[model samples]
Target: MKIAVFFVGEVRDAGFNASALAGADVATAEGLAEISIISGVRYDQDAIRARLAEVVPEVDGLVFIGGQGNITTPEIAAQYPGKKFAIVQGQKTGPNLASYDVLQEDSAFLAGALAARLTQSGTVGHLSGHRVPPGLKGRAAFVAGARQANPDIQVLTGFCGTQDDRTVTKAWAAAEISAGADIIFTMLNDARSGAIEACREGRARQIGNAMDWVEVDPEVFIASAIARIDLGVKGAIKDMVAGIIPDTPVHLGLAQGDFASLSMGGDVLDVHKEYIAKIAQDIRNGTCTVPNTYDGPEFQP
Candidate 1:
């Protein structure tokens, strides 16, 4: 089967896009299908629609990479009902479409808890590039987790508007730091560099998402919310190859092996790790639930 993996941003972003591309590579390497990548589309509705119109006819199926697909992909999928469709990190589903979400919120909540425990100023920050559902859920989970760990801890959250613009992210990060946030949790793509620079210069530590930022930069990252977006991509492609369109969304969380979890740096204390572990278990066992939405005031950068 000829399948096209669609992405809105640069696939080599070393973050969310990169993880999804890795999954596509795995699927193609497994001989499951002839996978082609359709990437570099800006975060624009008309551009995405035009690209989809151009690509859908040429491929047997299309697997969209992120929550961005929740809108255009479904509209396009409905137009092409005979063609199979899937969205990794998406919330929507249909008879001819499936959405696979690797619950990054699970780990984001843990990051919030850790940040609350580690913060000396009693204020932590959250900065993401987009206002998408996944990022919103992550922000909500982080806030919920921090409140759970320390009710008095303050969370200053913002969406800076671009996933790849370093200047914007840096400005936002610096602003958050200046506002007494000693720890910041960031969900960004290539723009993460901007946050790292701001954290380094401001003497603030950071928590990252998508991939393990702690493994990438120990000095800047105190922890990373590991969400296996790659697995979701691979699963979507594998299902497409098998000609199986799931009736329900494919939901993978901390309980589902290593699909989602938190990776801490050397700065994290043993006691904190134990606490996070207990919380993870509670979430898995249905004793705790992570919030999937945030309606609070947004920090303007």
Candidate 2:
């Protein structure tokens, strides 16, 4: 089977795109499918649609790598019903298309809980690049977790326009710190450097997403929401290779092994780690519900 792994940003982003691309590389090496990577498309809708149109006709299957695919992938898949389509971290699905989500929100919730417990200023912040569904869900879960941990804790959250714009993210992170946020939860890609710089200069701690940022920088990162995008990509590719297009999106979360987790740095207290563990169990046991939508006002930096 000939399958194309598609992305809307730089595949070497060292964050979301990098994780998904790693999975595609493994699948290709294992001979699961004849994989072709189609990257370098901008975040613009027209660009994504154009790239999809150009590539979908030539491949037996196309696996889009992010929630950006929730829109254009379905439209393109409908145009080519004979071809298999899947979206990792996506919500939409059709007969010929499937979506697989690695529940980052589960770990985002734990980050919020940790932030609530760790913040000395009684305020925390959230920053993400796009206003996509997965990012929105993560923000909502973070806010919900913070609220659950401490109802009076303040959460200043915003969605910056660009994921890779270091200047924009740096300014945004600084603004959140200026607004009294001591711990910021960031869901970004290559733009993460800006947030790290802001945190370091401002003496504020951070929580990261998609990969284990705590492992990368223990001093700046207090915790990391680990979401295995690579696993989702591999699962979608395996399904596509086996010609199994499920009717529903494949959902993987904390209960599904280490697909999603909240990794804490050495600075985290033992008691707080136990608290986060209990919360994770509650989410797995359905006792705690992570809100998917945040209707509250957005903090504009």
Candidate 3:
């Protein structure tokens, strides 16, 4: 069997790159399957349709790489009807499609709790690539968790509109810092580097996304919400190969080891360790559940 993986943008983004590599690696290691990758900067109907027209017929399965792009567009869905496709990070349901909805909001909530406990200024910041549902969901969950940890905490929010624009992200980070946000949680893809730079210059702490950032910037990065896309893609492909397609969305969270926050080698303050531990335990024990989208109550922390 062979699989074709489609990414919404350049392969440099850690989240998307990680998923593609994970899928390819799994296919290679499994010996019975082969995998290929196709990347595009645009998710427009025409672009996606053209790419799929060129790549879909040659592969036994299709994998949509992680990003904010919508995989359920009518054109793409109709073209690949009854063909096995695995979508990551976005929700789209079909008879032959399996969606891997990573529970990023839960990880964001833990990061928020840590920010509230660690910040000396009692103010936290959240920076997103865009105002899309995924980014907004993570931001809202983070703010809610921050308030749960510190009721009086002030949460600042901003967006860069695009993940590749670092200059705008730097400006937003500086502005958030100027507003007294001492700890910043960043969800931008490649734009996160700019936010990290701003945090370094402004002497503020940061929470990283997709993967840990302690090694990237030891002094400023306290912790990160790491997404295990490799495992997710492998699992999806394996299921398809085994003829075990799922009827509902495949939800992966802390409980399923799809996401985690590593404090090892982090710059987290001692005061925040207990709170982080508590939240992690609650997430594991099913005592705390965070929403994936804004369909829940408005988070005001």
Instruction: Note the Cα lDDT for every prediction shown.
Output: 0.92, 0.93, 0.72
Model 2 Cα displacement at 211 (Å)? 0.8
Summed backbone clashes in each candidate are 0, 0, 0
- What is candidate 1's TM-score against the reference? 0.98
Candidate 1 at 3: error in angstroms?
Answer: 0.3
TM-score of each: 0.98, 0.98, 0.89
CA error at residue 243 for candidate 1, angstroms: 1.5
- Which pairs clash in model 1? none
- lDDT of candidate model 3 versus the reference: 0.72
> Which residue segments of model 3 deviate by more than 4 Å?
43-45, 67-74, 262-266, 293-301
Count clashing residue pairs in model 1: 0
Q: How far is candidate 2 from the true structure (C-alpha RMSD, Å)?
A: 0.9
lDDT of 2 by residue, 49-73 (tens): 9988899888899999999999899
> Deviation in angstroms for 142 in model 1?
0.4
Model 1: per-residue lDDT, tens digit, 116-222?
A: 99999999999998888899899999999999999999899999999999999999999999999999999999999999999999999999998999999999999
The residue pairs found clashing in candidate 2 are none
